[model samples]
Each structure stands twice: as structure tokens, then as C-alpha cells.
Target: MPRGRPAGVPPIGSYTAVGDSFTEGVGDPGPGGWIGWADRLAALLADRHAEHAPPGSFRYANLAVRGRLLDRIVAEQVPRAVELAPELVTFCAGGNDILRPSGDPDLLAERFEQAVAALRAVVPTVMVCTGFDTRGVPVLGLLRGKIATYNAHIRAVADRYDCPVLDLWSLRAMRDRRAWSEDRLHLSTEGHVRVALRAAQVLGLTPPADPDQPWPPQARPLRSQVRRDNIHWAREHLVPWIGRRLRGESSGDDVLPKRPELVPLELPGAVEA
Candidate 1:
């Protein structure tokens, strides 16, 4: 069999990711680019390839767009992923959709199921992720219930399809303020790394490192500092997000997928600018 053969292929080779900003690595900006969880996952998978598969056989593509709704993800990215027909596919959607003022959880769940079913029919190893616990996010704490509801639906869907689920809601480590960006909407670089490690474990990769390590203690901001920081965050992130919503625009409006096609995997250090 070929090293990257589909049916009996190892998890390390040929992966495709589809969904929204959460998968796109929004807040975790890097010198190379935005090194989101998906990118980190790719790197981890590539690292493991040396054990079971050819070193250069691992490949990955991320078709996630920031601020995308569930329907748009299915309509646009899923078909492309299907065409690519990777050995593993990871999907995280509905987070952006559920954040809308008129968000409908039940309707979104129905759509989510449809997408999962579609992917499961073709892909051998499909993975779905749950939304994070939002109780720690300032101004977004009230949405925890909503996120929990969506996560429950995601679990049910994953069960029906026999797909591995990266239950982000269950990870207490992610609740730390340090795991998030100032926007409090996306993960920090450490957060993305942790998530990728967890995803690798879920895929039976058993990464060399662990994702559950405790974060170092952070200094509690002063009351005055908290207020000042909140003001700055609102001015920088929240205001622009609200403005985009009002204008019916998205951060990904003119942007293309960071990695559109699957190519031989290259670690950050291995590839030069």
C-alpha cells in the first residue's frame, strides 16, 4: 500500500480542516503567520509521521475563514475538503453562528448534523470540536449556557457518526485567562498549542508532550487596571467586531484560506521565508 493510502492510512498523513476563525487561528498571531490550532495540529501530526509513516508524507490544508457561519462553512469549505479527500478531517463551526443576536441553537444543530453526516460518508477519520466554556470570558459569560447546548448537540452528532470529538468544554485548563487573547474570543498561542496537543491525543497520536500542563500564575490586574484594559479591549476588538456586524461584513471577506492545498508537511523551523 502507498505510504499515504486513504483506507488504512496512518493519522499523520493528509489532513484537511474546515470551519471558522476558531480553526483559523485568529488571536495567535505569529512571525510566519497566524499559527492557529489547525496549524499546530498539522505540525504535531507531521512529527508523529516519522514513527509510522514517511517523514514527508504528511500534508494539510485549512479552509477555515474568520467570522464564518455554519451554513457558509458547509456550503463553501466542505465540498472543497471532499474533493481533496484527505485521510483525516477536522471541523469546528457554529461558534460564529451561535454568537449572532438572533442565533437559533436548534436550527444550527440541525445544519451541523447535516454537515457531519456529509463528511463522515466520505472521510475515514473525521473529527468535530466543541465550543469552549465561556464563563471566564468577560462580557461573554452569559453565553456559556448557549455554548453548552451547542456542545451537547455536537457530542450527539459525533456519536451518530462515530467521530472523535475534541471536547474543549471539558478542558478546565482552557478556562484560564492566559489561554485567551485580549479579545477573549480566540485562543492565545499557548492555547492553540494546547488544543493541538489535545486533538492529537484524541486522534490516537499520543503526542510527545501533554496539553494539560498547568499555566504559570498570572498577576491579578488592579481594579483600575482591569477597567482600563476592558476599555482598551472594547475600543480595539469589540468595537470593530460590532462595526463589522453592522456593516454585514466579516474579517475573512477578502481573505483566502491560509493553506488551500495539501502539500508535504513542513515544520516552522524547517521552512524558511
Candidate 2:
């Protein structure tokens, strides 16, 4: 059944996603490449709107590339999004900036405020996302305070502009290993689905599943096994990440946005990721 636009709901005919690996679908794989939460949310929004729009008129774009910093996203992607002038825009950058030791949360939020101000001027609805709680993760755990601080600043910015916020910090289910990819930095496929659902909830849309669905309890891992996993993660993922930093090379150094323009949404491109 085609869902009628709910009373008081903001009708989204078009949406443009802006961000880093999280929005770029770094961990979620589709035939097109990585299918992130942005694409999934686009699917949901499209379904709700397709019935009302002219055939194939409901459109979407994704300007996110992995490994992008907030400055670059604001400096490069933000202006382009403003030009596209979509009815809806999602802004979820600054995580890459948070990871840096010298990155200032206050300064990043200031830049973010400017970006949101620009988007809100032309866009009817602008959505933003918060950083995740990394207290249980290995290396990221150490930076939990910084992430929290940045998240606070983001929330304030969202409030100032009346923008909807997808809060990743309170998603307790995400602490589970199943929600994360092998790299430990990005979300797994399941995580992406959960986040998509959560984003829908934020937008006053009905999601098919609960983002906070409880996980089945299991026995605690043996300390030695945990040690082994840590060692393997360090070897397979951590070392290479460190190497990239030392060499000042980024994963997105040459990458481009998969979908740079607002077009009809394409989906279900499932691949054996």
C-alpha cells in the first residue's frame, strides 16, 4: 500500500546526503559499492513520495566520500548541496576531524553551524547526525570524551537551526561487535540498517524494524580469545591505518561520489560483501 503523507510530516521529494565514511557507506556493501544508511533512508523516503511525485521525479544524491574531514566537506560538498537545492539534506561530517589529536570540537562545531545555516536557508529540512559512543571499542574508546564533546556541539547546532538529529551515541545496540565491520572504524551491514531505521524515526517516518532491537545474550568471550582478536585487528586494520597517517595518504584521495546528482533512487543492489 502506498503510504499517505502523514499529518504534520515533512514531505521529502528529494534528498542529498553529505558526510564521510559513515554517509559514504564504507562498511555496507552493495553491487554499486558500499550501501550506507543514507541510501537506505533515501529508499524509505522515496517510497513514501513516489506515489505523489511525477513518474521518476523523486530523486536523491550522495556527495559523501570516505576519509573526508569536516573542513573539506563544508568547503567542498556543502556549496554543491546548496546549488542542488534539494528539499531535504542530511549533514553528518566531522567524525574524521574528531579523530585528530589537535582537532578542536568547538571550532568544528562552529564550521558545522555555518554549514547548517547555509543549508537551512534554501532547504526546507536539514538533518544532522551525532557521533557514536565508542566507550567499548578498542582504540576509539580512548577518544570517547572527545566524541562526546563533539556530539554535544553538534546537538546544539541542530537545535539552533531546528534541524533533526540522528543521535548515534544513545544507540546501545551499536556497542555489540555485530554492529561494526572488521575494520572496527565503520559500521557493518546490520549497523547500517539499524542506523537507517533510526534516521527514519528521527524524520517522523515509520521504519520497518527497531534500531534498538535487543541482541541475544551469549557467554562472555575467553580473555585469551579477546586478546587474539585484538592482535588480529591491530595487524590487519590498525597498522595500515597508522601507515596511512604517517604517509599523509587518505583512502579518499582519489575517490569520487558514487551519485553526484539528484536522480531516481536505485536500490536492492545486494552483493556478497
lDDT leader: 2
In model 2, residue pairs whose N, Cα or C atoms come closer than 3 Å (at least 3 residues apart or on different chains), thus clashing, are none
lDDT of 2 at 43: 85
- TM for every model, in the order presented, reads 0.92, 0.94
Q: Residue 57 CA error for candidate 1 (Å)? A: 1.2
lDDT of 1: 0.82
Number of clashes in every candidate structure? 0, 0
Across 1-273, the per-residue lDDT of candidate 2 in tens digits comes to: 212234676568899999999999999987769898899988888877866776566799999999999999998899999999998899999998888787899898899999999999999889888899998788889889989988999888887888888889998889899899999999999999899888888887778788899988999999999999999999999999989987988899999998899888766634211
Q: Model 2, stretches more than 4 Å misplaced?
A: 1-6, 269-273
Residue 33 in candidate 1 has what lDDT?
Answer: 74
lDDT over C-alpha atoms for residue 215 of model 1: 81
Over 185-242, each residue of candidate 1 has an lDDT whose tens digit, in order, gives 8888888878887887787765666787888877888999988989999999999988
In angstroms, give how far residue 164 of model 1 lies from its true place.
Answer: 0.4
Clashes of 2: 0
Please, what is the whole-model Cα lDDT of each candidate in the order they appear?
0.82, 0.87
